[model samples]
Target: MKSGVFFVAAAAVAWGMGGVVASVLYRISGMGPLAVSFWRAGFGVLVLVLVQLVRRRPVGPRALFPRGWVMIVIGLGLAVYQSAYYLSIAQAGVAVGTVATLGACPILVAIGARLFLGEPLTGRAVLAVGVAIAGLVMIVGGPGEVGPHPVLGIFWALVSAAGYAVVTLLTRRYADRIGSDDVGKTLASFVVATLCLLPLAAAEGLLPASNATVAFGWLVFLGIVPTAMAYTLFFNGLKTVPATTAAMLVLIEPVSALAVAVAVLGERLGLPAVAGTVMLLAAVAAMSVPVRRGSRAAVAAGAAGFDRAAPEPAVAGASEASGDPASAR
Candidate 1:
C-alpha cells in the first residue's frame, strides 16, 4: 500500500483508542459523559490554540469563525449529534452504540449525494445501502438488541448516528470552502454541545462535584487526549486521505470498542450482535467503495473550497500531499 494509506490506517488506530480512553476517565472521575465531552472540547481547543501559537501562524477570522453562518449551522447538527451519541453510548454498550452511529452514516451520505450534490446513485451504491439496511435491522432494530423492557438506549444512539452522518456529509460539502480553519466549525459544534447540555449537566450534578486530583486529571485527559488529541490526529489523517475512506476506517472504532468492552467491562456480545456487526462492516465497505474515477471527487473539491474560504497554516502545509488526494471515500 502507498504511504498515504498507511496514514489512513494510523488514523483508524488512533480513533479506535477513543472508547478505552473515555472509559478510563469515567472510572477515575465518574463524570457524566456529557460533562466529559464538554471538558474535552474546552481543553482540546486550548491545545489546538497553543499549537497554532507555537507555529507562529497569524490567527485570521477563518480560524476563529471559519465558514460563518454555514459552519455555525453545521455546528448545531454536530452538537446534537455528539450529545445524542455520548448518551447512547452511556446507556448502551460501546459495541452496540458505535456500530449504530458509524454504520448509519453511509446511507445519509448516499442520499445527500443524490439530492443536494447531484451525484447519481450508481447501482453499486444502492445495493450497498440495501445490504446496510438489512444489517442495521439485525444489529440495532433486530431481535438481538431487544432485552427486558426495550433497548431505548441503543435507539437513541441510532438516531445520533444518523445525525452524525448528516454532519459528515455537510462537512464534506462545506469544509472545502471553510478551509483548515475548519477548527472553528469543530469548536462551534463543541461549544454548542456544552451550552445545550449546560442545563442537563447541571441538573445531573456531573459538572463540578468532584474535588479529587484524580477527577481533575481525568477531566483534563478527557479534554486533551480523546477529545483534543483524537481530532487533531483525525484531521491530520484526513489530510493524508479521502473523507469517505476516512469514515470507513473509523469503522474500526466499534471493533475496538467491542474488544475494550470484553476485556475491561467483562461483557460478551451475543451471537446475533456479532453477526450484525459483520453485516454492518460489509455494508460500510460497500458504501465506502471507491468510484470508477477514484474515491470521491466532490468531497475533495469541497475540502479544497473550505480551505480556500478559510485557509490555515497546517492545512497549507498539507497542500502538497492533499492537492489531489486519491480518494476520501
Candidate 2:
C-alpha cells in the first residue's frame, strides 16, 4: 500500500514537470496543442517500443495491439484527456485549466469506483477528498484573466476530467488482468492516440519552425518522463490502490507544476497558494494512510465479488509481484 501511494505520488510529480516542459515547448517551438500532443504520443511510443526490445518483450504488432476493445477505449481516453487538457491551457490560463480538470477528476473517480468497482468510500477518504478540493480552489483563487474564451476552456477542462476518470476506472477494474503488461498497454494506447491525433496535428504543423532540435528534445522528455514513466508507475500502483485514492493522489500534479513555475520560471507563490499547497499535501498524506488489516480485508472481499478472477496465470503473477509491474508507455 505504501508503495502504491509512493508510485502514484511520484507519477504526479513527473506529470507536473511534464506540464512545465510542454509549456516550454509551446513557447520555444510555436507548436499548437494538437501537434504537441501528437508528438508527445509519437515519441512516447518510440521509447516504449525501445524499452520492450531492451527487455526482450515482444514488440511485434501482436503485442503492440493486445486486449481488444478495452485497449482502444483506454487509448482514446488517453488522447482525449491529454489533448483536451492542453487545449484548456491554451484557451484558459494554466491555473484555471489545471484546477478545473484535476479538481473534478477525484469526485468523478470516487463516484465511479464506488458504483462500478465496489471500492469503499470511507469517511476519512471522503474528508480527505473534500479537503484536497477545497485546497485546490484556494490555490487557484480568483477569476483573474481566465482567457478570452473562459467558457470554452472550462468545457475542455471538464471533458479532460471525464476522460481521465474513465481511464482510471477502467485501469483499476482490469488491474489483475493487466499483470506486468504495463509497457504493452501503454504502447498500445500511445499507438492509438498518435494515430488518432495525426491528421489534426498535421493540419496544425507537426514540426516546429524555431529551435527544432530543442523542441524535439523537450518533446522526448515529455514522452519519457510523463507519458512513459508516469503512466507506468500509475498503472502498477492501481493494482493495489483503490481508484478513488489514486485520484486524490493525482492532485499533486498541480502542486508540482506550481513548484516548477515558481522555481524555474520565476513565478511567485502567494501566501494563499502556499497555505493551500500545505493543505493539499496534508490531505493526500491522510488519504494514503493504510486502513486497518480487517477493514482492508473486508474491502478486498467486496471488490472480489464485483471483479471475477480471470482464468489466467498472469493474474496470479501480477498479484504476487505487486511490488513492481512492467510499466506503461
Candidate 3:
C-alpha cells in the first residue's frame, strides 16, 4: 500500500510538472503549443519503444496496431487532449488551464462512461457534474485579466477535458481487445498521435530546428518524464491501489501545477477563481467516493478485463489493478 501510494503520488507530481516544463520550453524555444505537443508525443513514442526493447517484448505490427477502429479513436483523442491542453496553457496561465482541464475530467468521464460504457451514473455523479460545471463557469468568468484571451483558453481547456474523457472511456472499453502486450496499446496510440500531429507542426512551421539543442532537451524531458514515466507509475500503482484511491491521489497533479505556476512563473488567480478551484476539486472528490455497493465490484471487473486483455510484464506484480479514467489526463 505504501509503495502504491508513493508511485501514484510520484505520477501525479510528474504530470503536474508537465505544464511548467512546457511553459519553460515555450519561453526558451518560442515553440507553439502544437509544436511542443508534436515533439512530446514523438519522443514519448520513442521512449515506449525503448522500454519494449529493454523488456525483451515483441514490438511487432500485431502488438503495435489496434485490432480495429478503436485505436484510431483513442489516437485522435490523445492528439486533441495534448494539443488543446498546451494551447490552453499558452493562452491562459498554467494554473488556470490545468485546473480547468483536470477539474472537469472526472465529470466528463462519468458522463461518457454512462452513455457509452453502460456504467451506472449515481446521483452523486450527477450532482458532481453540476457542481463542477458551475465551478468551471466561475473559473472562466472570474477575472478577465487572468490570462490573455481567458475565454479562448477556457474553451481550449474544456475541449481538452472532453477529449480526455473520451479517451478514458475508450481505453476502459477496449483495453482488453488491444492485446495482452506490455504497454503495446499505449505505445501504439502515441505513435498514431505523433503521426497526426506531425503534419500540423510542419504546416505551422513549428518544427524544431536541427540546431535548437536546448528546445530538444526540454522536449525530451517532457516526453520521457511526464508522458511516459508518469503513465508507467500510474498503471503500476493501480495494481495495489483501488481505482478510487488512485483517482483521488492523482488530484495532486493540478495542485502541483498550480504551485509551480505561482512559485516559478509568478502567476496569480483572483478570489473567485480560488473559490472555483476549491469547488471543482470538491466535486471531483465527491464523484470519486464510492457511495454504491456495486462500485467496487464494477471497478474490479474492469481491472480484470484489462488484465485479461493486456498483461504488462513490466508491472506484472501490479497488473491486476483497475484504472482511474481521469488518470489519462
Best by TM-score: 2
lDDT, candidates in the order shown = 0.51, 0.74, 0.63
Clashing pairs in 3: 180-310
lDDT by residue for model 1 over 1-329, one digit each (tens)? 13434544554444445555555555566666666656656666666566567767545555655557665655566566667765554565443454455556555665664565444556666676566555544433342332232376567766675665665556555555555643444455555555665676666655545445766665566556555555545544444344444455555444444455556656666675477568756865664545544435654554454335322220000110111100011
Candidate 2 regions exceeding 4 Å error are 89-93, 306-329
How far out, in Å, is residue 232 in model 1? Answer: 3.5
Model 2 clashing-pair count: 3
Alpha-carbon RMSD, each predicted model: 8.9, 7.5, 7.7
Cα lDDT over the full model 3: 0.63
Return the candidate ranking by lDDT, descending: 2, 3, 1
Task: List the candidate numbers ranked by TM-score, top first.
Answer: 2, 3, 1
Cα-based lDDT at residue 10, candidate 2: 90
TM-scores, one per candidate: 0.67, 0.88, 0.71
